[model samples]
Target: MSDRIDKSLTRKKLDKTLKPHWVWAIALGSSIGWASFVMPATWMGEAGPLGVILGLTLGALLMIVISISYGVLIRNYPVSGGEFAYAFLGLSRLHAYISGWFLTLGYICIVALNATAFSLMLKFIFPNFIEQVKVYEIAGWEVYLTEILLATILIGIFTVLNIRGTTISGRMQFIFVAILIVGVLTITIGMTSSAETSFSNLTPLFTPEISALAAILTIVAIAPFAYVGFDNVPQAAEEFKFSSKKALTLIVLAILFAAAIYSLMILATGVAAPWQEISQANHAWGTGFVVQEVLGTGGLIVLATALTMGIFTGLNGFLISSSRVLFAMSRGKVLPKAFSNLHSRYNTPYFALIFAAVIAIIAPWFGREVLGWVVDMSSVGVSIAFFYTTYTAYKLLKWSEQDEGYNPELHIVSPGKKVVTLLGMIASVSFLVLLLYPESPAALGMESIVALLVWIAIGAIFYMIRRKELAKYTREELAYLILGKDQFKLKKEEE
Candidate 1:
């Protein structure tokens, strides 16, 4: 394997987004598993305050393992494709197909959920405009026209930002995430005095019921989503100068910052309203829920405005991350070359991004709790990706070149790394096993294999038969493929 070379112009411009420290900070912070706040965390905590706490603790523990191991992989085998890129290096083309398919589907689900949230916010800010959907209902249509319109607009914005390239997209992420953290803190602190929190509720004592474990696993499992957005951060690696080191640091810091922020918000919100009441009264959170809960009318307006912008930013995150995954797949010839194309001017993958937006625009009409369903599948994608990477890591440790070739800066063989990666894989596989059970699958396996398979098939057919026409995006992805090329070989280099 070759060292990562600065052979591409597109990558160089992307480096301008953030230098080393900013790269690590932005990437790490950007991936903060945010949907946990938007979806299950609030409801779970509300439904069973103790239950959610236990679950969050358990899930966070597992995620810590998963995340650290993921970081190791990123540090060792940095690349533009998130999980898919890693898999392609270690696993067979078949597993590569599997990983990319799941990630693309997972990202689509992310976009769908983000777009859905954006549309819902639009309805809140302009109820009359959304109320126009009633007119569509009268026409015997099952879909909500206004919701679709609003969603399309959000998707359009994401596609446009993504077309502008990684630097712009990543900075956009930093801006939104920054505001989102501040807004959440302001609301949580202003509303719930930290001293008011009941210490007993802070640590729930669960009975001997399995519900405790399952529920906790579900909650903790979600923290991975908070970190999942980092998947896109690496997609822009080609744009970084010292991507291997800088990108890894950025991804890790982002996770830590986000985790801290979430803990504070949960603490504040938990104090403001009892878990059960918040769960029962306000299952869905947005501008209305946050404001009404925190500051009444004033809070409502403030939260509404912040939420509107935050969710729109989330949509942008989805657009850039998901499309990048597809773009990476396209470059590998697993997908159509069109997906790999760069806008000669903006230096973004225009067609793949537009493709992502179109699907995101259409997802809301499914009216099926877009986030709820997507979260389950996204969990699957996360786990599957983790599983492959960890297994590859195990292989890396056992078989990488040894006999004096070593990376003292890297720590793949340390007991801590080993234990965590193993446990992370266990946690991921456990969630997957739980999904096989019909009763719990919906809660943890919302990602659609059918959907994934269809997308992969489409991508493959286009690549094999239709790739000749689309211009290819180029430049060497050396370090990009090295980390996952089998751990044993890395050991050999260590020698």
Candidate 2:
């Protein structure tokens, strides 16, 4: 083979430093951030305790099915940018750009959400220590200069850590996640063992105002945000030291584990006191207040510790994922080429990391309440990416069977596999409708809708600005840049 052919086959850029456990930690950490800690009461308020369990379980099952499509694509392509690379190869460059843009929005929003959540956690623990120096107010929530500074400092620390390399960040993720799990388990045990707790406290299981089905769908609608981290597995496929076949198992496990943690937190919150009372209380952090109410100072301390770890893991994991997506898009010429450049010693996407961090740092200035609006909007973005990925897998499988010249090494050749991807597509679409449809229980408010529209408009304008430059590259050249010339050649050989 010529040197050109040799260069095409190898992925010598990003270091393969992620172990199986680190990947799992990243997925679980990303999925179980501030929402799991602070929003249990909100979920209880929306659907009641039983509704929270039902919705999260159903949502997780749906995600597991969707992950099957991700598994298929990762095994076949195993590139960074996850769905971005899949859509580019199985669909078109336009589809790829759409997927990358929305997914990037979702990941970056989560990163900012976690950073802002850090201040909220501190407020609950110290009660105005970090809430000093009020800067402004938006949407009934005050934006404190101290909070912004604290959040910015956290974002800056993670940015430098991530720019150094993945191995360091990955190891830290594993440790933080382990401590977080212990903290959650401690809370669960304490709540269950307490004399003040009772299963009867979970009465009026579903909210009377909404139908039970609607209540369940409410949680299911935001499942994309709740279970966002598992897809990070695909985003880091290029950095996997293990077999791509393992990606599916890791993704599924992460989703299931995250679901359990969410359920436990809700359960602990419910049994600690009359969940209805807690739901109705004027507490800023309902779960925190309830835990502290029943278990006192000891309980509050444990819960605070867990919340801190959850925020850290979220920041670390999402930074890694968001940067990788940008890097992959840049390498494929979907974005500016500077983002594709890796650090000399770290072998990491330095420019992309810095860019994501800057966006996250700016988010706190908008006030913590406004970040929630962006997060709700970002759920729609993630759903769009999920649809594209599942649809691409379905399309690839159909082509393989119908075209005499096409055959890739699919692990499971069962006729039923296509049905899974089809179901995934349907599920993905349902989540989107539940979020975007006004009649749906989980529909976004006007503010969130405006945010989503603004993001879409910005993405469209940015793509048009880069379209002419991207148009200059042939499909083959783009494929070589994204999939590695060797991998692209191998794909051609299979076809």
Candidate 3:
């Protein structure tokens, strides 16, 4: 083995202040957003309570397997950019850019997705106030000036809070997550304790029209989108005060906790009233409708409060995550270096935060359905990142085993880790198949497919433009910037 020094490049680092609990809060909070509260109708309609619960449980298991791959990568290379950095180290620069591009799509679009949900929640609580001043319509969904203003204001607030610093944002995330948990428990307990509820209301475990496997697969296919937050941990790895090994436990715990909350919300919906009726009733907010039925207007107020917090947490978490991804990519010279600029006093990625917020603020103008198409497309991007990380782990493990000169001191690969990485890759491919396969129940709509194509085209154009700028640097110089000075010494032969 040979090691060489690359002295020309200097790495920029984020502030390290995230505690273990705060990291957990970030992952859990980001995963459980307005979708849990506002949109159970589609899943509940396709799969009854039992099917949904089973599906989510299985999904969590798959995520845990994938988490093992993430943990292995983090243990070996604890850096910012998560999958982007991993792909570059274990795969190639081209793979890294692809991973970063898709990961950016997933993280940044979610910021807009959550912000748009805020306007929808306002419309639910104060229809007269929020629905006024109709601006325009896209795909039959009305765009209101009030809604746009509300979303923009939210995006702006979170952008400023994140730019202030991660310490401030992490603490705020912890508190908001606590409130969210309390509110969720309150709603679930109230709905379950109501005299009108009967567990039998969840009967016919699967939707009669669909096969049981399909019912469960429908939810399983969206697991990448649903369980995205845990990966955010890797994005902030450079700033982790604690050891990266500890993050694996936090990730698994967060995934389990999120899964429990999701199942409880679905259970609350089913038991409060006949799930079939709630599904068929087709209320804009099915969960909200049931809450009002069980606990009256007071319950609606509590649920709305919880949902608002969810939206807030989602906005804050994704802003932190997306900005960090941008900063990492910029540091690697894959994106414009301007994105890596930091705030003078606070030391946050101000340019990236502002850029992410600006993109999100513009989303509400196009209306909710248009945003939905983007989100649907973004899920594919999320799954792509997952696959890249898992595949990277698989490559590293196999390389370690096959290389006669492999250094055990460098990385100790436990006997069964190779198997786990293989399983993780299989699970990731399954998620992709479910989303992209036309015959699959969870396949993307035509609009979402078009959105996916557009995003890929945009990435291709940007990559071509960036490659010319990057031609000035040798491969070693590029590795020093992306993997840092210490890691660049350990770089493998270029593929």
- Separately for all candidates shown, the number of backbone clashes (residues 3 or more apart, or on different chains) is 40, 2, 0
Which 10-residue window of candidate 1 scores lowest in summed lDDT? 486-495
Clashing pairs in model 2? 8-486, 9-486
- What is the C-alpha lDDT profile of model 3 across 278-344, one tens digit per residue? 9999787888888888899999998998898888888898999999889989988889988999889
lDDT of each residue in 1-495, candidate 1, tens digit only:
334433442321122343454354444443543353454335344334455555545555565566665666666665557677666545554465577777776777767776666656556556677756443332233447777777777678767866876666656666666666677777766666544445344344332234665555545545556556655565555556565655545655565665565555555555554455554565446325644655677666655555655565556666666776777776665676688787888767788888888877666676645345555555666668778776665444422336244454443456556676677678778766655455651244324544434555665775456334322311234223222231223321110
Candidate 3 has its poorest 10 consecutive residues by lDDT at 1-10
Q: Specify the poorest-scoring 10-residue window by lDDT in model 2.
A: 486-495
lDDT of 1: 0.57
Query: What TM-score does each of the candidates earn?
Result: 0.77, 0.94, 0.96
lDDT of each: 0.57, 0.86, 0.85
Error of 3 at 263 (Å): 0.3
Candidate 2 lDDT by residue in tens digits, 1-495: 233332443333688889999999998998888789999988999998999899999999999999999988888788889889887876678888999998888888888889888888888778659878888888888988988888889999999999998889999999999999999999999998999889999988998889899889898888998999889999999999899999998888889889999999999999977788888886889989888988999989999989999999998999999999999999888988789889998889999999999998888888777888988888888898899889878866652355554555433354566799999999999999998889888889999999988988998999899899888765666777777643343243121
* Candidate that scores best on lDDT: 2
Shift of residue 339 alpha carbon in model 3, Å: 0.6
Q: What is the lDDT of residue 398 in candidate 3?
A: 47
TM-score, candidate 2, is 0.94
lDDT of 1 at 282: 53
